[model samples]
Target: MRAHHLAAAVLVAALWGFNFVAIDVGLDSLPPLLFVALRFVLAALPVAVLAPVYGPPAPWRYIAAIGLSMGFLQFGVLFVGMDVGVPGGLASLVLQTQAFFTAIFGFLVFGERPRPRQIAGMAVAFTGIALLGLDLESIAATALGLTLVVAAAAGWAVSNLLMKAARPRNTLHLMCWISLIAPVPLLALSAAVDGPAAMATALRGVTLETLGILVYVALFTTLVGFGIWAYLLRVYTAATVAPFSLLVPVFGMSFSALLLDEPFTALKLAAAVLVIVGLALNIGLVPGRIVPQRSART
Candidate 1:
C-alpha cells in the first residue's frame, strides 16, 4: 500500500472506531431505528444527486439487496443492539466476529476451505471468546446485544458475498444504490417499531451535541469513510484491503476508552489481542514453505 492509502486505511479505522461512541451518543436522543433511518437517508443523498458524475445508475435488484442487507439490517440491528445496553468496547469486539462468520460462510456456501493458518486463528479466537464469556457483567449485558449484532454481522457478510458474486463494475454505483434503497426499509421499520412518537420525542429536546454526533456518523463514517474504503478496494486486491480492517478493533478499544469511559479490563485486552492475532493468522501472516509435487511416472 502507498503511504497515502495507508493513511486512508488508518483514517477509516479511526473514524469507524469513533462510530461506536457516536452511536452511543446518538441513541441518547433518538430511537435506534429512527436514527439509522436518518443516517442512511443522509448517506444516500449525495450519490443520488451526483449519479451522472459517479457512474451509471444501479438496477433495482442490486439496489434493494445491498440496501436491505448491508445498509438497513447491518446498521439497524447494530444500533438497536448497542442501544439496548451493549458496552461500546465489547460491542466493537463482538462485531469483528463478522470476519469469522464471513470465512465460515465462504467455506460452506462457496466451498472454499479455510487455510491451515485460518484454522489456527479460529482456535485462538475461541479462546478469546471464552475469556469474554467468563465475565459476569459484560456477559449479561452483551447476551442480547451480541445476538443482535451477530445477526447484523451475518447480514453484512451475506451482502459482501453478494457484492462479489454480482461483480458490479463500479463500487460507487453499488454504494449509491444501497444508500438509495436502504432508507425506505429503515423508515418503514422505524415507523412500525418505534412509532411516530419516537421521532417527535427525539426531535423535541435534541441538543447540539446529539446533532453533531448524527452529522459525524452520517458524513464521516457512512459516506466519506466507506467511500475511501471502496476506492481502495477498487485499486487493490481484496486481501490487501481486508487486512487493514483488523486495525478497526484496535481503534475501537482505544476510542471506547476515551469516549465512553469504558475500562480496559484484562479480559477485554486479551480478547482484543487474540482477535488481532486471529485476523493476522487468517490472512496468512506466517510464512509457509512451497512444496512441489513430483511428476508421476507413466
Candidate 2:
C-alpha cells in the first residue's frame, strides 16, 4: 500500500477503536438493543437516499441475513456484554476471536483451508482466551459478559460467511442495505426483552449525550470507518489491509485506559498481546511484510 492509503487505514483503525468508547458511553442512556437499533437507523440513511440514483435495489434477502447476524445479533450481544461492565478495552481484545470464527466457519462451509501458520495462530489465540478465562472472575463483568462477547464474534463470523456468499460488488452498499434490515427487528426484540415500560422510560430519558454517541457510532465508526476500510481492501491485498484493522484494539485499549480510567493489568496485557499476535498471523502477515500483486476487484 502507498503512504496515503496506509494513512487512511490508520485513521479507520483509530475511529473504530474509539467506537468502543462511544458505545460504552451510549449504553449509559439507551438499553443495549435500543442503542444498536438507533445506530443502524442512522447507518441506513445513505442507502435510503442513494439507492434510487446509484443502482438497482440491494439484494434484500442477503442483506436481511447479514443484518440479522452482523447487525442485530453481533452488536446487540456486544452492547449487552459491555453494559454488564465489561471494560471497553477487554471487550475490544476479546472480539478478535471473530477472525478465528471466520476461518473455522469458512472451512466448515466452503472447504477453505487455513495455512499452517494460521492454524498455529488460532491455537495461540485460544491459549490467550484460556489465560483470560483463568482470571474471568477478576473482571467486573464476570464470565457471562465475556461469553456474550465471544458469541458476538461468532455472529460476526456468520455475517462474514453471508457476505462471502453474497459476493456483493460493493461492501459499503451491502452494509447500508443491512442497516435498513437490522433496526426494526432489533428494536422489536429490545422492546420484547426490555419490556414496553422500560423502553418507553429509556426513550423519554434520552439526552444529547446519547444522541452524540449515536452520531459518532453510526456516522464516524460504521460509515466513514468502513468506507475507508472497503477502499483499502479494494485497492490493496487483504494481507496488507487486514493488519491495519488489528491496530483497532491497540488504540481501543489505550483510549479506554486513558479516557475511562480503566485498569490495564499485566495479565490482561499478556492476553491482549496474544490476541493481537494471533490476529496478525490470521491475516497472513509477518513483520517483514509480504506485498502481493493486487487482485482484480470483485
Error of 2 at 154 (Å): 0.6
lDDT of 1 by residue, 1-298 (tens): 6788889988998898888888877888888888887787777777756776756455567667777887666888888988886776677777877777778889988998988888888778757766776773744456677678767777778887777676776766566567777778877887898887877878787889888887898889877888899887767766667777887878887887887788888777888788778877887654354222222221
Backbone atom clashes (below 3 Å) for every candidate: 0, 0
Q: Pick the candidate with the highest TM-score.
A: 2
Per-candidate TM-score against the hidden true structure: 0.88, 0.95
Can you write out model 2's per-residue Cα lDDT over 8-53, one digit (the tens) per residue?
9999989988999888788888899988998999999898677887
Native-referenced Cα lDDT, model 2: 0.85
Cα RMSD, model 1: 5.7
Mark the regions of model 2 whose C-alpha exceeds 4 Å error after superposition: 55-58, 289-298
